[model samples]
Target: MMASVYDIWGAGFETTVATLQFAIIYLLNYPEVQRKLHEEMDGVIGREQELTMDDQKRLPYLCATIQEVQRASNVAPINFVRTTTEDIVVAGYLLRKGMNVIPQMPSLHLDDKLFPDPERFDPKRHLDKQGNFVKSDYVMPFSLGKRACMGESLARMELFLFLGTMVQKCEFQSVDKDAPPKIAVTP
Candidate 1:
């Protein structure tokens, strides 16, 4: 029990911090994206109003931006090794029961077929023409399946609250406006 607790705390802390840092860097690299996020946040959540998880639905652009950040950052490229309970065949490759396999999450996030010009940092991919947040199966930052991150819900709420509040209260900019730092998309 204690080991599981430690794993959750440590893993959650590391990933969240890395993701937030990458978010700031990405925002700096793309000021227009940051401006749009601010516009959405200010419009949905007024300057004085506090942000909550309930606001997530109303803030479509914010949601899309966060999703884009997760997709572009690829913070956790590989998930924990999961063993198959029974024999299975994936992509014509046979795997016997109890065979351990790791999911390469970046492959999905950076797939050109799924996300055209995958390297570019555009959040519109996660939004529909009507400006609604469109959740994608490919943007699995917290992994997927039964063995997915145990703290997935908690981490998501934290991210929504933290990122929402930060954008509401702050205006991030590059230290050198003339030459913005390049974003390192890899984890």
Candidate 2:
């Protein structure tokens, strides 16, 4: 437990900051969506009340926006590369032994099939027919399968709690009034 504590401190902070940055960027870009989230929060938690972990379930739009942010951010642009131990068939393509494998997280997140109009920053994309929060399988921001990040649950819950509360309390705006903040793209 103490082993990666040092590593986790820096890496964890980096992730949390990046997630919040993206959330702020998206909210600034789309005022309508921001207003919708604000309205939803006001309705559920009320403007004068503070948000708590229990409020996450009640904040569907806020939760959806956070998910969309993570989906769009894909912060860990380059995932750990693993080599194939033996030849395997993937997506109808045959892989050779010892071949390097790179998980294209951003590409998958932006896939039009799993997520319709993937390029658009729409929280409704994560909403169900009943307008409830619906997690997307396409969001592999923390990688996927057996090789996924170990702190996925903690990180996700932290982001949701932090961002949900922040958005509920204050109005976020970029420093530049005229120029729109750029969407962070990691190549």
Candidate 3:
């Protein structure tokens, strides 16, 4: 009944690394966010104490920034397939029973109504006017509903801890100083 240990770690590690690489690249481009994170770390954990999992909730902006990273990463563009239990009409087309439905996770992200300036990377959008993490109905890196990633909660916790620990301890400078901006290519 259990997935192989290799498969579990493989799925978890590869996606986690890719997400972190994107986060590092974004933080490099936005130094202010990095600076703010550093300040928050210093304020909460102080220069002497090592950060712990307990520190995750105390770091509000850091959490928001991480969520934004997950949001903007767009790693899993297309969602998993599911069969409809009953007939339904969608966009003037009839979907019969047992028909396969694959929602576009990336397309929902690109919707301007949900994410303004869909091209720009902004973490503030994840936070409400009161500077708290406002829940978004969108953001489906692991897809959504019943077929959503089984490791969703574990992934979120690990990401927050990893990012908070790394940024708090060391500095990262991009080696590709003159690399051209990447162009979007849909598959």
Candidate 4:
């Protein structure tokens, strides 16, 4: 019981922190994106209002920015290993039953075909023409399916609340005003 609790706590803490760091880095690198986030948050959430999960649906740009951060950051690049219950063929490769398989999440998240200019941090990719947030199956920062991260819901709520409140309260900028450091996504 203690082990399970520790795993949940540690996993949630580490991944969320890493993602938050990437978000700050991206915001500093893309002032325009940060500006748009601020605009949307101010318009929908307002300065005096406390952010909530319900507010997440109303903040399209903020949602898109968070989605984009998860995609671009590739915080959890590889999913946990799974064993095939039965023989199957994937992409023409035959696999016997009980075979161990791991899903490479970064490939899907950063695929040029799925996300054009994948290297660039653009939240518009997750936005529709009408400016609504569009969720993508390919952006699986917490993995997917039945075996997906157990702490997904908690982590998401934490991220939305934490990030939303932070942006609403603070303005982030690079220390070196003239030149910001280039953004890099490492696996």
Worst 10 residues of 3 by lDDT: 178-187
Query: Each model's RMSD to truth, in Å?
Result: 1.3, 1.9, 2.5, 1.1
lDDT of each: 0.90, 0.84, 0.78, 0.91
> Which is superior by TM-score, 2 or 3?
2
TM-score of each model, paired residue for residue: 0.95, 0.90, 0.86, 0.96
Model 4 is weakest, by summed lDDT over 10 consecutive residues, at 178-187
| Best-fitting candidate, scored by TM-score | 4
lDDT of 3 by residue, 61-141 (tens): 888788777777777777779898899998899999999999787787777888998767777888778777765778777
Please rank every candidate by TM-score, starting with the best: 4, 1, 2, 3
Each candidate: how many clashes?
A: 0, 0, 0, 0
lDDT (10s digit) by residue, model 4, range 14-34: 999999989999999999999
- Model 4, residue 113: distance off in Å is 0.6
lDDT of 2 by residue, 1-187 (tens): 7768877777777888898988888888988888998899888988778677788788888889988988887888778898888999999999999999988888788778888887789999888899899988888778876868877788888897788778778898778867769786673
Candidate 4 — which pairs collide? Answer: none
Ten consecutive residues with minimal summed lDDT in candidate 1?
178-187
Better of 2 and 4 by TM-score: 4
